[model samples]
Target: MKMNICMVGALLLLGVAASGCANNRDLIAKSVIPARNDVFTEGGNGAQAGRAVVDFTLLVKSNLYYLMGTYGKHTAPPYRAHLNIDGQTTILEADPILEDNNSVGLKAPESGTGWKYQFSKRLTLAPGKHRLSIALPIDDVIVEREIEIRPGINTVAVTPVYKRKMLRPYKGENFSAGVKTVEIAVN
Candidate 1:
């Protein structure tokens, strides 16, 4: 009789524990990742030039030299930089243009910043502050920045830089074409 009572008590405890775990299986949501993917998508030359202007702004702040905004979504890493020395604005091209894509070039022997340029004899930048005007490649947005030059060794931190990804074209297609939701049980 005592053994039977003990069995009943153990069963009751086991059932209570099982039920507690089952109730918790509803998911208490330890962390909710509310992440949003904000993007920009437009087509045409006007749109591209607009992108170049946007990229020029974010590039200089952190050091990557060329930051991409929403407008630079169409092409694979698109941007051309132009620096205004005094009153002259010179267009700089990527070195080995096709090889590096200058898309990721961050070397400027002159200003020591970044420009789509080849370091041919340590470039030239007069003492003072200069303006940068970047061109959009493949219809990219433009972002502008200002750089200061002083005669001597200068260093800038350019990290956390991101490469631009092509904006996927939007078409009226079924988003849930073949997606199915199913659940299975494991023992």
Candidate 2:
């Protein structure tokens, strides 16, 4: 009798898990179709109206590592990015521009290891609320925000920040725990 009850309970749990997965699949299917359609359709006739300019900048570290005894200067890798606003998607690619001493939150070691690359874009958008999505495929970073674009110039900055544990001084185990999150700030 106990064996039978255990089997029945297992079957019931399996059924519930299957049903939950089905419901999630249905929800994703329904939502994806509309988003796909929105990408193709024109936004509206608001092109002649007042517009706002968005200056977007993304700062990320290159995959290349500069060692203490490195001989020559190495160039950063190229990156591909996607900027989507209210269903309008623009694909961007750029060779990484090398920069130095642009660290945030904490100061770097005396070896002068604070180096990064910058990618920038200027977008003209209609004055209204917008859904902004930024994706860096190579870096596996995606950030989404609901932003209000007023008439004038606005700035959006995307940066990769280090994890809290990684910021601590000279911890052996946490040394490899790099970026914690990608932060997006608008002003």
lDDT of 1 by residue, 1-187 (tens): 9999999999999999777544322221211111221222211222232132111111221122234631111124433333332334433334322122234332321122222223111233333454433322222223335655444322222111222222422322111111011111111
What is the RMSD, in Å, between candidate 1 and the native fold over all Cα?
23.1
TM for candidate 1 is: 0.27
- TM-score of candidate 2 relative to the true fold: 0.55
Candidate 2 lDDT: 0.55
- TM-score, every prediction: 0.27, 0.55
**Per-model C-alpha lDDT, please?**
0.29, 0.55
Candidate 1 — number of clashing residue pairs? 19
